[model samples]
Target chain A: MAKRTPLYEAHVAAGAKIVDFAGWDMPINYGSQIEEHHKVRKDCGMFDVSHMRAVDVTGKDAQPFLRKLFANDVGKLTIPGKALYSCMLKEDGGVIDDLIAYYFAPERYRVVVNAGTADKDLAWMRQQAASFDVTIADRPELAMIAIQGPNAREHFWTAFPAGRARTVLLQPFQAVEWDGWLVARTGYTGEDGFEITLPAAQAMAVWNKLKDAGVAPIGLGARDTLRLEAGMNLYGLDMDESQNPLESGLGWTIDLKDPKRDFIGRQALAALQPARQFVGLVLLDRGVLRSHQKVFAPQGEGETTSGSFSPTSNKSIALARLPVGVELGDTVEVEIRDKRLQAKVVKPTFARNGKAMI
Target chain B: MSIPAKLKYTATHEWAAKNAAGTITVGITDHAQEALGDIVFLELPEAGRQVKAGQECAVVESVKAASDIYAPIAGEIVEANTPAVDAPESVNKDAYGTWLFKIKPSNPSEYDGLLDAAAYEKVAAEH
Candidate 1:
């Protein structure tokens, strides 16, 4: 049997279709996935993302330990409650996992990793902490809830009035603690909202309160579509341990400016020359674009990493890894079964903050 | 669960009903649509195409994955439902009412050989 989240009973009560996702029995959809996608685009929707693990790193050497582990510079996070998106890599520049690290103080930091990679991430963190003076504590007792959309903040504030003061003042990519709950302005969906981490025992009550406040219960299916449209990469689908950040459209996250800071993957990344380019494609035809489909460009053949029909754009969009010679505005052919359909290369972002960015 | 007694069904979850004109209308079953979740797109065979029994003739793509809609019996495609093709979600709304294609069977006995509602329900339940 798959592991169940704290809100599993609530999901069953809402008539959700449950599926096994990364060993967790999660809701794929309540009813229409298209409607759920649009609900997040137009109104407010809440997702139970408790399956993702949050690990707390503390002690005197927390900063230095994370500095050596992450490709992105955690030393840049000077302000408390500021979060940084970084890829934790191995010694050979291969990405182990991409995570969001929130800096609370010099000795205290919290990192949230992907659900599928949680156990591996914790093991890696423990293995790396042998020489450092840091304690890595996995907080499985916490349940995470992501409330997202244009009116998401308002709905969240309505549900939990106690968090209104701090949640209202939260900046993008920032988090605040309120009454033992960590409410963050960061979200996977391209919307203004909060990813609140609270006691797992209290998850059902909060979910019910949000539902009563008119926040629609969204599932993992809509979450995938929303993140894809926002140009966010899913961990295993977009990149893995064999892939590096430079060729995975995550070059901006890597901080190589400081000469003295020698991270785990720094030497490998510095000596390597990236040969592939990651880009976005908008299908010019009627059919949908899917992952692992062959992409034929003027430069060379590549494959789509993630693809789906965007409800906001009313067209199919994809994130593809192509040859470095392929440029923007160029039309590429994607092999969809028997036909090679045409798609236009463009910027990866299709929508953000309830607005179309393409 | 809404299997029509007059219609025939395949183990692959396609339903076929004989019309007054002697041609048979084909569509995915209610159970199939429920399993598929949301129908995003449908790729139907051309009107004049010839098909063999159990041959994969059409494609139905849902949010989850793409599924092949196989031909229930040997037949020639007479008409493809353009409306259903344009709005694929109608299949989810009413699977029986939303016909995918009409076929003029080469041998009418093959259509009769298909499982009826009761037998098809048993097969669907096992799945």
Candidate 2:
């Protein structure tokens, strides 16, 4: 049997179509995926992201432990409540998972990981922390809600007016904790938003208040399209344990500045030459792009990692791992069925903040 | 959600409505459109083409995935809906009103062998 989040019944009451996602019964869409996708781009929409796992690592050894664990250095997060996006890798530079690390202090930090990989992440972290004097605890009692879009913050303030003063001055990637809730100015939609984590028991009440205040409930269908259009990567579909970040358009997140810092995957990444370049594709012909589609270019053969129709661009866009010589504006072809359709290479991001980039 | 009694349905989810001109108008059922979710592109059957029953002649790609539309009976294509192909979302809005193509049946008696609305409803429920 699939596990259900605290807001599952609320989604059912709103007539959402539920599907199993990472062993959790999650809403795919309320009615129309396109309509829901537009809602987030134009106004604001709420998503029940409670299925993802939050973990806390706290002790004198916490900071050093994280510095050794992630590809991105936690040492850069000096300010309290500042977050860094990074990938945890295996010893051979394979991606174990990508997560956001929130630095509350040198001794206290929190990390949120993808739902399907939560168990493995915890086990890995715990095993690695065996020699360190740190406590690794999973926050299963918390429920996460992401309110995203151009007008997300205003709608969020309108829902819980008391939070206005505390979060109004928050910058992107910053967070604040109050009333037993952690409110972060971070989101996956490439929009202005807050992902709030509060007590699971209070989730239904919080969801209801947001609904009454005009925050529409979105689902996984729109979530996928929005993130794809924003040029963000999905965990399992875009990369897995078999792949490394250098070939996944995530070299910026890896902190190579500290040559002495021997993170888990640093040695393997330094030894290997990246064979592929991560880039974006705009379909020159009419068709929706899907993941695992073959891409043909003059440089060599490549493949799309994740793809879909961009409602904002009114065309199909994709993130692809292509040959190193493939340049922007190069015309490539994608095999969509029995036919090869023309496409143009572009930057990975197609849209952001209510605007279409391509 | 709607299955008209006057029309016939195939287990594959295409609806065949008999026109007074002795031609069969074909569109996907409402249930099919709902399952597909936001039709984006369509490749309808071309006019003046001969197709046999269960032959895949049309392709409907939604925001979710692409699906094939098969011929309900052995027939020669009389006409294809150009306007519906241009605005594929019209199928999701009104599946019955938005016909994909019209079939000039080689043997009109083949239509009788197709499932009626009630029988089709039972088949749709299993899905």
Best by DockQ: 2
Regions more than 4 Å wrong, model 2: none
First chain TM-score for all predictions: 0.99, 0.99
lDDT of 2 by residue, A4-87 (tens): 999999999999989999999999999999999999999999999999999999999999999999999999999998999999
Candidate 1 to native Cα RMSD, angstroms = 1.1
Q: How good is the docking of model 1, as DockQ?
A: 0.69
Write down the TM-score of every candidate.
0.98, 0.98
| lDDT digits (tens) for residues B1-127 of candidate 1 | 6998989999999999998898999999999999888898899999999999999999998877789999998989999998787898899999999999999999998988999999999999997
Clashing pairs in 1: none
Q: For residues A1-358, what per-residue lDDT tens digits would candidate 1 score against the true structure? A: 8999999999999999999999999999999888998899899899999999999999999999999999998999988999999999999999999999999998999999999999999999999999999999999999999999999999998988877887787899999976778999999998889899999988999999999999999999999989999999989988889998888899999998888898999999999899998899999977888898999988899999999888788788899999998999999999997799999999999888776666
Candidate 2 residue-wise lDDT, B36-122, digit = tens: 998999988789999999999999998878899999999999999998867999999999999999999999999999999999999
Model 2 residue A66 lDDT score: 97
Worst 10 residues of 2 chain A by lDDT: A235-244
Question: Which candidate leads the pack in lDDT?
Answer: 2
CAPRI quality of model 2: high
